[model samples]
Target: MTGAPLLRVRDLNVRIPTPGGELHAVRGVNFDLNPGEVLGLVGESGSGKSVTLRALLRLHRPPIVMSGEVEYGGQNLLKMSEARLRSVRGSQISMIFQEPMSALNPVLTVGEQIGENLREHTALRGRAAQDRAAELLDLTGIPSPRARLADYPHQFSGGMRQRAMIAIALASEPRLLLADEPTTALDVTIQDQILRLLLRLRDELGMGLILVTHDLGVVAQTCDRVAVMYGGRLVETAGVHELFRAPKHAYTLGLLQSLPGAGAQRQPLQPIPGGPPNLRALPPGCPFAPRCAHVTDECRAAEPPLREVAPGRLSACIHFDELPALRTELQEVHA
Candidate 1:
């Protein structure tokens, strides 16, 4: 993190028109990703993790308003023209979407899909593109990749489809990859395989990655840093081990408590009380104030700003200092 960041996001806000009103999907999100760093975005469903990731590439179409400075390599991606953005999309900053089954074209062969990317970004064409596609597939650990190139999306298993998605994303050798729940649809073993494969590829290519997932276990295993998002905002961020060992935010502590421990086989999981707030009409103060056990009268007066509470850690909580003692108390209760 000493060198200049590969990607810098500042004051990112996304709004989507909804029947209820304009849904504030992402709210003033900001983060920096250094080269070769893996930053995990962990949150419950509807927490805007995916939206924020997509905003990096300006992927959303009309009716969705995005305001932010997504600077990469000293260029503002948010202000880039559509044609310019298209050139940057798969070549510089690629994305592996949540579900490959839907993302992959049903009518096209895997090789054709891959060749399209190669044609768009790289100079490889026809037979050359096809050969490169096979190489990419083999790199992803798919057996007989050359033969699989002829297969359709339906012909591949769920795990293989996800691998194919990864292969397609890597066709252009992007410097930054945005993976949205890449392993969500696979079995436990396949999930592990995918995570390991992603890590290996990141190391091999020296690429920065942003992984979006609800699973804390995945973040713990793969990410260098973890950003916990809630109610369309980042609630806490820190180094992976530091955040796990001693969470600084009430919401983060609640999330850790909800995870099932290895020692407590029969112990009931302590679910976070209440649900995420309604983004359409978020509470005036801290969005998590209603569900936070550490909530104070001051917490409901105005939203707490996300700020550094310690070295390499950020938290949006007026009571962040009390969390360590509260964590110990939660452990005793679970014990």
Candidate 2:
């Protein structure tokens, strides 16, 4: 923990205009990312995890509306001018997308891509930029950096491309790195290598990281804190150990129990009962109530506000107090 958070998101909301009406993609989401900490944002597809990250970077297109404070280094990113945001984006914060093939330029060499940021953010040029680019490649564990500098992205393997992405992201030495499923396309072995590389970079650079993914296993291995989102809202947040040890929200417990290794042999994994609620026509109460086995009448009528159930543990379920009993029963049934 530091004196003040490096990034603070307060009461964030994002909506889009649809033919039916407006779709609420995110609702009153709030969190903080401290320096040198890894915050894991986990949820199913369409849970607004990607949208929230895009909104932070001001990447959403037209018809998509956003309201909230994204405070970074004393400046509200949401309120900054386009020019100011441009100054902040690469130099102060960098983002890595899941698909490197799409993110990288097909026409440019790997060195040219990494050097682009250095040229834009710094005064380095020609030989200096080339040297720095090679250095970044080396930093990211890309072998034979000098030899690879002249190679195009298509010449590299999937893991190498991701490593190049990391090199580009680190070229600016940003204070924060937003990685959206950075290892999605890689094989399992390569995925582990990438995860270890990311952890190494975080330790060596002391930069804050936001790893957004649907894989709880990734979160368990790489994150210090975890936030579970459902229906575009944060339903639970806790330290990684606390969350895995005794999850407080039904959704959180379900997610943990649903892991492939959570149950016995030949038994089907118990997925969360129902699909995520529709953002355009969400229910009045808890968005997860329909799928939650612990749901009650109150859960259907009134939305439960996120409240602190224990020190540094917060859940949005009304029956969070009874989660322990429910967890035990579910484990027994699945055991």
Candidate 3:
């Protein structure tokens, strides 16, 4: 049986009104996630990765306006009423944020936080909710689940608190999971463990996952597909292996080349020059043009929409076809 996509985002735009002006945090982003599939939304800071994810959950506050379609299970979330959206948030879709300390309520015990969703979304009461909460904690590999249920967020280590957050996110058996840099503040070993836990949960629950991160290595290891963003726009989208092996967009290539082990001789890291353009006043042409090495006059005249450069691979660069091929210089550099 062919299941419909769990979540679909199309031409999404989000703007936050500031005293200075409206800051466009996300623009024209599009992607879909099928059940049991992980789609990585990757980019540098302020590249709209987190904004896109928050838009999916309808988590933005007032003065933060959002537009476009966020379809989930045939329903357009953008059009859902506040009450209906609340029903969807914890039960149908959930988010595990970057910082567990901030995300979790300090006053509530870990068990209470996990059980809060069960009580709100399900008919479970008292002991039943408590039992289910402990089960979730155990499922997330928290030892001594029963005893730890009484422990507050401050009592646990950083890694354990993150696991608690994941446990809460999974409490409602959400069909779509949004993890926004879920492993960001953890140690490498802890990060790997968290990634593995997420992958295992996805496989077992058959839930769609959107992993927002700056770590390309995490994307390569955990995602089936990836969308690369820059300056509030999607620069490229491709299957995991295809993107890593043959990144077509110049920005994409630069990202891959900038990876820790891209070349053996460890040539001076070639960072994409310049900071992200100010969202309040974007350039008339391609936002990446100023920083792109291969920019041409034509590229500075108009913005380029993401177009299919190959099967399942899309790039927004106008001169994507003429971009130089990236050779594996590891061997040569080493010799």
Candidate 4:
């Protein structure tokens, strides 16, 4: 973290024109990713976690305006030409989308898809590309990689298809990987396998990873640090251990309390009081004010800026100091 970050994002905002109106999807999001560090983007659905991820790559098409800086290695990705960005997309930065069935081309064989990346990014061709494709598949723990290459996506199981997605993403050996809920639609055992595989690949390949998920347990298990997003903004960000040990935001505490800890009693989970705010018409003040247990009149006046509440910790709560006291109460309730 001391050195220059591999990726630096600041004041990122995205707007889309919908039939209803303009939808503000992501607002003033800021974070940094160091070389080989894994940053977890945690939040419930519609919190803009996925929107921020896609914006980093300029994946959102036009009429959906995106502003602010996404600097990668001193270059701003947002300002880059489509041609230049394409060169960096798969070879330098890759993403494992949330779903494989729709993301993968059903008509193409698995090998063809993997080879496409190779053909575009590398000099490897023909037999060489095929061999490397097989190697990549094997690396992702898919059995009989050579044989599987001939199979279409429909032929592979769910887990195998996910692995194939990873294989294609890594075919170019990107320096940074953006995974949007990579473990979704997988069984517990398979989820564990995918998470382990991701961590292993990160360690072995020394890649910076951004994992987007709503599960705090997954964040606790895989992320080095976590950035909790709410209503299209980052509410809290801290080291995994520190965030879990001493959460400094009401929304973050709500998330942790919702999780059933080890050996917890058999009881109903404490769900958050209200649903997420509507992005189309966000509140004038803090979007989470309505649902926040510790909300005050001041909270409803204006949104608090994300500021350092502690060393190496950032929270967007005006009464961040009061959050620690609620931790005890939360523990007692869940106990």
TM-score of each: 0.96, 0.94, 0.94, 0.96
Off by over 4 Å in 4: 264-267, 325-335
Minimum summed lDDT over a 10-residue window in model 2 is located at 326-335
List, residue by residue over 160-238, the lDDT tens digit for candidate 4.
9999999999998999999999989898888888999999999999999999998777787788999999999999999
Judging by lDDT against the true structure, name the best candidate: 1
Q: Any runs in candidate 3 off by more than 4 Å, and if so which?
A: 1-3, 262-265, 325-335
lDDT of 3 by residue, 1-335 (tens): 15677778898999899999989999988887888899999888989999888998788988789999999878888889999999999898999998999999999999889888999888988999999999999998899999999999999999999999999999889988999999897888898899999999999998889999998878877888999999998999988877776777888888877765543456666787788889999988889888888889988999988999898789999988877665543333222
**Could you give candidate 1's per-residue lDDT for residues 28-135 as a string of tens digits?**
999999999999999999999999999999988889999989999888999988898889999999999999999999999998999999999999988888899999
Off by over 4 Å in 1: 264-266, 325-335
* Candidate scoring better on lDDT of 1 and 2: 1
**How would you encode candidate 2's per-residue C-alpha lDDT over 93-197 as one tens digit per residue?**
999988999999999999999989999888899999999999999887889999999999999999999999999998888999999999896888888888898
lDDT of 3 at 257: 71
* Model with the higher TM-score, candidate 3 or 4: 4
Each model's lDDT: 0.91, 0.89, 0.87, 0.91
TM-score of 4: 0.96
Error of 2 at 256 (Å): 0.5
